[model samples]
Target chain A: MTLLIQVQLPDGGWAYILSIIFVSLQVSVTAVGVSTLVSLPVALLVGFTDFPGKRVVTAVINTGMGFPSVVVGLVVLILLSNSGPLGGFDLAFTPQAMMISQFILATPVITSVSLSAVESVEQSVRDAAFAMGGTDADVGLVVIKEARYGIVTAILAGFGRAISEVGSILIVGGNIVFSDGQSYTRTLTTAITVEARQGRYEIGLVLGAILLLLVLGVNGLGSWLRSKGRGERSA
Target chain B: MTLSAATVSVSYGPDTVLNDVSLGVEAGEVVTVVGPSGTGKTTLLRLLGMFRRPDDGTITWNDTDVWGLSETERLAVRRRISMVFQEPSLFNAPVAQNVTYGQRVREPWRERIRKSIRNLVGDRTLSESARDALDTVGLLDKADQNALSLSGGEAQRVAFARALAVDPEIVLLDEPSSNLDPRNTAVLEDAIRRARERGVGVVVATHDMNQAERISDRVGFIYDGKLVETGPPSQIFDTPNDSRTKQFVDGELMYDVEETTNGQARKSTSVSP
Candidate 1:
């Protein structure tokens, strides 16, 4: 306990804490940003348009929401492996790989929820917009604007899932980090696991505390953004 | 400036809502369609506005068959003929935006938007043509307010303002004053009078016989999805020739009267004048 306290008193422990928070936030933000960018148009299309195989596409997307993160990690790994096609670019076992895996895991969540949000906008509003000589693009913009608050909530929920997820990032990132002598990368979850196996309970507890605080902070900001968006819309 | 519908019939499945309804409106005319509920009064206005397709009819505007046109051409025709719904149907936007909806202004007209407002509403510092339209409807004070905040009558007036802002050649009103108080109804009637004076053809659908008689130069009576009679208001109201028209205007069932009085029912039909 005394050694753990002494370790935390130094700048090294503080650096580790900050680095973990930064990596977690970077991974989460990138995952959510990419998912949001990719999912919005898909959500709008599913919500608005009618065509053949629409039900099949919707069913696939709904099925994707419950897809296991480990499976996503494995799929990405197989594609980015050295023996796989186009694997010569070598993005495996890197932060970028983790980002891609997290994005795949988060996308369906955002898409499904956003589709519901966009669908909830009244059809009367769409009719009114079209009657005013607005084109399809104009109607889409108006519907998205009216559904902005709900879409934001969907995105925030995606972020929450991305940050809290560990399985995909662990497999894809390999979360290695170096200290004292060598270079490596290590995520909060992986580091805690390694420390616990080494009987470094204090270090694992500290990391756990930091992870809890990070999740709380994310949830807090998400709620704040949702409320702010709601207020702006109502006003 | 001239709107004409010939043999217009609208059907949904086996149920026909309007059948062989022919009407014409020239510039400076206020034509009102008076009927009981579900008698195709509103459906006739929608058909004229090109919002609904007739199963068997042609709508011609100024001698041009509008129904035969392509969708784009139909939209152009629709732009020329604006509609005011029974309810307000305003957007969740400011009043100004609602009025200028679907209207395009040239560069010169864009600059004149402010000036046009002043010209339309003399001595008032009008913001835009929308404000002037609201002024025309006597709701200028509510121009900046959210459209959703309006009372039912005020919202309907806003809808009128929106229709007026487009400077349409023909205006189709479906029960415009049906949801308003008498004062608001008078305001709407006056607006209709002004619209007619400006040579804008007006076709209003109403269930109120007195209101229709007050504003309409000509009135068409629709009964059971068919046009029963149409003529000058004096002819339709004071000198109706059809037994069904008399029974409707007098608010009684001719069948019941016939059954009750047998031979005496024929006298009551002539007595409805």
Candidate 2:
């Protein structure tokens, strides 16, 4: 606790804390942004239409949602390594590798949650849109519009998962340190792990507080969005 | 155009909702289907609108058999037909957008651009037709308001305006005024007349006997997924050909009249929809 207090009071320690936060946000935001773009359309397609093997695909997505973060990180680490299939991109231990790993981890969760969100839109709205001479595409748009807030909550859930989990990103990002003591690939979670290992409990405590605050802020936004969706449903 | 469903049959899972029912409506005609709840009035209207294929029959718009045509052709036929559900089910957007959705959906843009721009502009700036449609339904003043913010009756009127905006040849209404007060019902009736004036065949499904009488050029009495009787409103109300039809029209609420096995006495019970 004394170390945590010292880290916050010193200007240089504050800079260290801010740098970790910047790296964490960059990884999480890039990952979840890609996940949102890919997951929403896939979710809408799965949720709104009838197709063969739908149940199987849905089950696969559900399994992927529960897959461990460490396993994801290991697989991504292998792929981005110097001799691996994706090594041509030379992204090993870089922020781009972290983002790729996070996107892989977050997409299934976002897609599964977004499937429920899109399905929860009232069927009558689709019927009305179709009955209004709206083609196949139009009904899908109207449904997505009605489910916008719920989709936002799904996105926040994805962000929550991407930001809080430490195992996979740590494995892929390498927690690199520069000769000047600056962090290159160290995010708050990875940095917390390193600081705690080095007996610098103050940095770990500070980073833990930041992670908690971020998670709480994300969850608060989700709850607010849920209420907004319910309000519109009543309206 | 004359819209017709010939010997149509529809079933959902193990339950058969419509059975070999035939009906037709010519241009400038107002046809009303009156029945108790679950009598397949909505099903019949859906078939007429080409919203679904009949399980064991054929439907036609003009002289083209809708079921026999390719999917693109069926979609083309659907473009010329519009439906208004019992619940308004307006989009969660402005009234102008809801009214202009039909035209904006089928514009000449690529599919991706169509999806993104769908809410941005409504049929080239909420075109004159949408406003004129709103004016017809007394909702022109509420054009920019969020569609979901309106009262139930007002929302139905917006739906009415949306149906008219597309200039469809047939407008199907499934209980358009079932929950409305007399004043709102009168407004809906006026809208129906306007649709008919535009040479659009209007098919309405309702349990309200007065509305069927007030708006129908021909009244169809449906019972247990069958058109038990059909005629001018006076004949159906004053002296129905079928006893079931009489039992239905005589009781404002849904009621069943059964005879004893001995065929000597009659028992009557009202069923809530």
Candidate 3:
């Protein structure tokens, strides 16, 4: 009777569940952190400075934002494969490859949105800073300080892009299940793919529920930050 | 020391704003520029405030051409002057930070350390000076509030207080009292008086003849991007030499108001297919 009441969960649930969650968090967070560090200066330079061919640079970045994940996966797989140019160090099918793929996918998402965010500030703010005897550096910092909420939103969007993707990470990570009865190179998104393909309906549902919750949590935090930013002025 | 703009000219793409304009502002004096809307009053103010470089001529403080200095040197010179625009233009921060903005509060690392020592010994002199500026503008009670939440005129007053907190040698105002009520206007004028009393030169651009008449030591009437006439307030108001100035002071100059209903009608009709 005790055996009759038993039910199967995702990899029998909790043991593998926490591991998978940790792997997903580690990869997405690292990708987002690196992406933000690289993209912030790009956003600032594009948003603030005037120079020749700025429109071309903006167009390229804007186009990159809509690049297909499958196409990015194909390109990265070729680059990291044995016959490809960057194969000397043998980085293929490793966590590092997944990180590089996610980083590339996340950067344009953060950069384009952050560029628009910085550009949306009122030009009068710059003039006022100058009038108050602020140097150019002071004015730049003031503008960035004012656009903090939008920059945060850009980060969240990039994280969402990196974490929810399967096409790129699968090609780069190989999604292998090891003989030790544990999944290696398996993230929540890639595990969902494996479970759904194997007709393991319950496991797929559980992993999917967690993924949705993570996305919801990030979006909720973004909205809260934006409202708090608005309240300071409206208060 | 005197701050003067000599033969200053400014243009906006195709249209000229100020042409061959020259003015000298002496310490302890209030020089007001009066003109119709769009005759480049704000442009003249921007040129004086170092917010814009003129198309021609030079601005000199104490007989040194401002643009002749290096960028860092120019910035140092700019720190000694403050400008208040028609808009309140306050940051979203608390009123205190807004007041302390132009005082090198966020100085270089080395300068900040020295400033911290000065603060420790002087017993918060900068904070007290900010409070004194707010008190002069009658916003001392609201010092801790977010500056953006103030009413339009109150925000402008906060801006004035912020300018004063810097202890600048010159104050440039661009129609600061145009949208203000009488009480707030009175408060602003009193603040201007205090700045002048501190031996600070004041340059104001305004359209209200009565306001210009009330506060000015010398009044320059600008017309068609040129200083058509300039004299003492009593002389310009009571005995003007230019017909254009008389027409303007008497409210008879056509095409004077930039946003007149007739202009709007013509604009709309012209845009119709």
Candidate 4:
């Protein structure tokens, strides 16, 4: 009975479950953080200013909102490949490569949604700020402060997109789980695929459940932060 | 400072709104511009505030041509002048911030927030400018409340306090009491009187001839984009030089109708349409 209890699978790795969860958490946090910081200023500028080619820039960002994760991964792959100009950086087939792909995938969603958020601020608020002898920058800051809750919601939406995507990470990171075992990088989605292919159904099921829980946790936090921000504003 | 506009004219596209309008406002004096609807009274106030450039004219403040100033210089001039719009225009910020807007401070806002609070809610040891302004407007108790929470008239009064907090040389009121009830209107009139007592020149655009007569030292009647007549309140009210001014004051202007068979008829006889 003890012999039968011992897992029979490719490499027979018992600690793969914890490793996959850790890797997934790392990727999700890094992707969300980098994308949020990079997109905020772009969103604000696009939302408020009127520069040359603004319409074209807006159109391009809107189109980027619907860009597929796989397409983003493919583009980054080409840029980081041996024949590509950026190949000297040696970022391909690394976690950083996955991060770059996820950043590209998530930024436009944040920017477009944030633009909508800023646009929805009342015209009266803008007029009041202007009439108070506020300069353009001052008025813009006031608008951003007024729309802070909506902007946070946009960031959460972008985070949701970045964390849930599997294709970009798969292509750019190669989903390589190291043999050293203690220091491996294998996300939940890739680990589930590897486990399921080797007929380890129980491990795959557990990993899938964890992934679902992670997504739910992120969404729940987003909703709570949005409500908290709104309550503060009203109060 | 004395404020004067000479031959000020404003046009929107092909439509002329104010034409060759000249008026002077002396320090510590209240001047009211009375007009029928669409007579460009508000446009005149905007021109005086430097918010709009005149088609052909100059506004002289203390005998200096205002139109010659650059935008930055004009903004600096505007800092010494404030306007109270017909409707209260408050920011979305808290009441304290709104009152202290356009004020410059050498310290960080967080460090200065306590000073602002003391100014808004008067200290027993010292007189507070914000508190005095609010007290004059009958909104001293509502100093801590959000500006958005005030009633329509209360908001307008708060706007008056905000203007006063800046200690401007001149205060331009665009029908400040037009939206207020009789009680609130009385409160506003008292505030205007107090502002005048503080030596701030007051220019008001109003349709209520009675209020104009009650508070104004001088009254000017605007008709068809022109300064039809202007003189002391007694002269403008009792003996208007222009027939258009008389028709407007007597409520016999026939504003809606194209023409009336009885030019002096007090009541309507028929509807053309």
Q: TM-score: which candidate is best?
A: 3
Worst 10 residues of 2 chain B by lDDT: B258-267
Write the residue-wise lDDT of candidate 4 on B99-183 in tens digits: 6664522235585567657765764222276667778888777666667767888888888887887788888888888789999
* Model 4: number of backbone collisions: 0
Candidate 2, lDDT over the whole model: 0.83
User: Model 4 residue B65 lDDT?
Assistant: 83
Clashing pairs in 3: none
Clashes of each: 8, 0, 0, 0
Ranking of candidates on TM-score, top first: 3, 2, 4, 1
A143-172, model 4: which lDDT tens digit per residue? 786777787788778777877778878888
DockQ score for candidate 4: 0.27
Candidate 3, B1-273: lDDT as tens digits: 788889998766666677899987998899999877767777777777777688899999898899998988888788888888788878877787688777754367587567658755653344777888999999998877889899998999999998898888889998899889999999999999988998989999888889899889899998767898999998788889998788778776544345221112111111111
**lDDT, residue B260, model 3:** 25
Residue B164 displacement in candidate 1 (angstroms): 2.6
Ten-residue segment with the worst summed lDDT in candidate 3 chain B? B261-270
lDDT of candidate 1 over A162-182, digit per residue (tens): 877888888888876656422
DockQ of 3: 0.55
Report the error of model 2 at residue B18, Å: 1.9
Per-residue lDDT for A1-235 in model 2, tens only?
3532556332345666677788899999999999999998998899988999999999998888887999999999999999999999999999999999899889999999889989998778888888887777778878888888878877987898899878998899998766665667888888888778888887688788989998898788788877876675465
Docking class of 4: acceptable
For every candidate, give the share of true A-B contacts it also has.
0.12, 0.62, 0.74, 0.22
